[model samples]
Target: MAEYLKLGVKNEPAMSQASLGFVGRSVAVAVVEDISHNLDPNLFTALKDAALSTNPDESKQAVKAALAHGTHPEDIADFYIPALARDMGDLWCADQLSFAGVTIGVSRLQAMLRALGPNWASDNATTNENASILLIVPQDVYHTLGAIVLSSQLRRKGFSVKLFLGGKPEDIANHITRTKTDAVFISSSAGETLEKLRQIIEVIRGSSGATCPIVIGGSILDVQEIHDVTALTGADYATKLPDEALKLCGLQETEKKKISARNGT
Candidate 1:
């Protein structure tokens, strides 16, 4: 067996055992590391110039060339493309990147996993044959990128999701009444919104008789906080990916045991 692995790029070596798979991971890492380390200072400058240039076709050509010459197409499509589109305020381009078969890179994979919540909920809905999921975001929390990504992931995973983005408390109550959803997901990008979220949970509980589980997630709910909030709301907190969240809500003993073991309990 070859002890030394030459990743697809010219001079990079495989950094981890997991990268040895014959798929794109090794090549992807090599390309990203190489470009990050050796690309000239002018590359990003050129890309920005192209993104901001007056001639649309020429600007796109320039950006494409920059991506093609220095970075793997997968990396560009997955990580760089979305980040660039976001930084540039071009959501249309970001949507294009999602559909462009961009293999999610390691750094961005965490966000992608976070987005998988709705999918897991949807799967649970179908399997039970009597349940559905309502994905809820607060009125003030405008960051729906995670939700949008998660919605798509859930759809791909064969779950139905009704996304109520930035809804008022009344709107959420009305949605729950109408849909009789199996689960509700509340996501916040900031910790400052925790009080507001707590209020919303209280309102939902008071009005809905605590019928459905309200799952909270995002950067705000780290490990300890997930448990605490779940206790506070009398709902559940999804500390892991969406699938894990769904399993927790459904109370699947085997899945719960597996998660416990993974968590070293």
Candidate 2:
């Protein structure tokens, strides 16, 4: 973990324009395949089109259509948005959409995420707020909708989650030291960002100490082996599953909390 901080945030590879296509296509196929079964195919297409459209109300209407179709908001946020983000990335890589078009699409998706609900990022449903998690997304990461949705999911499960979109390693360390964090989750998207993860993990270990577990997730995990990421970054665990992450950190929720969250009680 000490190795993580030496390189710190300063060395994160800037996502050059040339590599954007590579990064986009690298993970898109897997993401598309993952959500194909869970989401309504028609609704997914509508959301993608709305996000890519210029009309501001188009995305809103798409979301409304989803709700009217009896789709849950959580499902839209968790499954659909991430899949759509990847589809947009794939489109950009295929030259079907200009860079500016993809950017607008991603921005609209983010706006829709915020509109999911007041508690999308924080749920008071669970009384166990003592267990907390720090969810981080390096500044270079392009798709953060997954991390945000994960935050909501974790909060619903009774964990107090603190999410950091992007920040310097020192800032991250300082925050970890200041807060009583049980686990640290760093989400990465591109292959070029792997080395930077090593640095960030090091910083997290440096400040939070070896006792606190670090788990890496996001699109990178979809394409890479779990062992590869953990071995490279010196993270305690690497997975996209929240339950596994919590278990690794020795903070898994009680069965009662889990049941309650599922029952929406």
Best by TM-score: 2
Model 2: lDDT to the true structure: 0.71
| Candidate 1 C-alpha lDDT tens digits along 1-265 | 1111111123344334332221221111101112343334465445444443333344456545765676543343334433433433332223322211222222233332233233432434343334456766677554455565555444444455777777888987776666666667776553334567778888777767788777876545543476666666555565536676677667344444655666899
Indicate which candidate wins on lDDT.
Answer: 2
lDDT of 2 by residue, 1-265 (tens): 3221221234345558665744463323212236667878888878877777657788888898888878898888778887877776666555566555666777787788777766755533345656777888776554556677677777766677787876679889899888887788877774545688999988888897776888987667767888898898898888777777777777875545655786999
For candidate 2, report its TM-score. 0.78
lDDT of candidate 2 at residue 3, scale 0 to 100? 21
Q: Candidate 1 at residue 195, lDDT?
A: 62
lDDT value, residue 55 of candidate 2: 76
Off by over 4 Å in 2: 1-33, 122-126, 222-225, 253-265
Error of 1 at 264 (Å): 36
The residue pairs found clashing in candidate 2 are 4-199, 4-202
lDDT at residue 239 of model 2 (Cα atoms): 77
> Per-model C-alpha lDDT, please?
0.49, 0.71
Q: Which regions of candidate 1 deviate over 4 angstroms?
A: 1-131, 222-224, 251-265
